[model samples]
Target: MGSAREALLDAAYEAIVSGDWAGARMADLAARAGVSRQTLYNEFGNRDQLAAALALREAERFRALTGQAAREAEGDAGAATAAAVTAALTAALDNPLIKATLTDDTSGLLPYLTTRSAAIMDVFREDSVAIFVERWPDLALRPDVTAEVGWICETAFRLVISHLIVATEPVETTSRHIAEVVRRLMRDLTTT
Candidate 1:
């Protein structure tokens, strides 16, 4: 990427992580990255596009991390999947950029997710399914395993929302629920 592009992303990311999303206004971003607002727009299109891009970038980073963990987990799909869910939840809660995006009322990520824009959240679903399928394959899954996987991902994402956006519970407490989802799913697959 060009320096300007890198700078914009970096500045946007920093502003989010530092609780300065507002300070990251377009003019502020342009100034911080040594570009004009027009240049920033030219590079990233607009603020909404910038937000989406940054959010996707963070998602990519998360997927890469989970993918590595999933590979390390092969042959032990259940154990690996459980661990991956735990790791993903923990990392997402602790991730400044993620927290900023999900919890930041001003930015509108939560509404977008809660609404119909699966386009944004689908990355998580696709990445999760891909990682699980890569390690376990359809043959390994019980007849009901696919449904279980879907439920697990949906519930886990909701927990993240509840914990971060609504402040309904502590993160550590919420992440443990992931274990239950995994347990039931994996047990079904492994048993009959």
Candidate 2:
């Protein structure tokens, strides 16, 4: 099994995914984790910290999957970008906690993704930029190219996140469209 902290995090995830983020009391989460409320507080400090930890954990999970997609596509940045976007979009759609966090107004989880995104985005951008660097090592289309691949990766990531939150179109369609855009950009850069 997992450690006590891991178990607590798992229980918190379950509670949040079950549509009880607002109603899931700390004592209740503690009970579900088979820990005392004092233990929960000692482990997570407070509700905001617990939520932050949860969000970071989820983000890390998505990043790892996306990184795997990029790695599998190997030497093919376009395909890798597409694969990563599709993977993230697909996973997000299947995750109830993510759906509720994005669409549910009462969960109070949206701010962690929106208003408090800078810290998360910084970490995400660093890791994602590394993925792009690994995918396209000689992308020196211009003298001032300056991490163009990173820009594309971050932009695609933002588009996917926006699509997840606003849902302007079907996830499949949006992912395909993102892939096409990334492919076209990569093509243009390689040609010049």
Off by over 4 Å in 2: 139-148, 183-192
Give the per-residue lDDT digits (tens) of candidate 2, residues 39-79: 88998998888888888888889888887887787545667
Residue by residue across 80-170, what tens digits does model 1's lDDT show? 6546655666787678776776767765455544663355456666666666666668623554666666666566555555555565555
TM-score of each: 0.71, 0.82
**Against the true structure, whose lDDT is highest?**
2
lDDT of each: 0.66, 0.75
Give the lowest summed-lDDT range of ten residues in model 1: 108-117
Q: Tell me the deviation in Å of residue 72 in model 2.
A: 1.1
What is the overall TM-score of model 1 with all chains considered together?
0.71
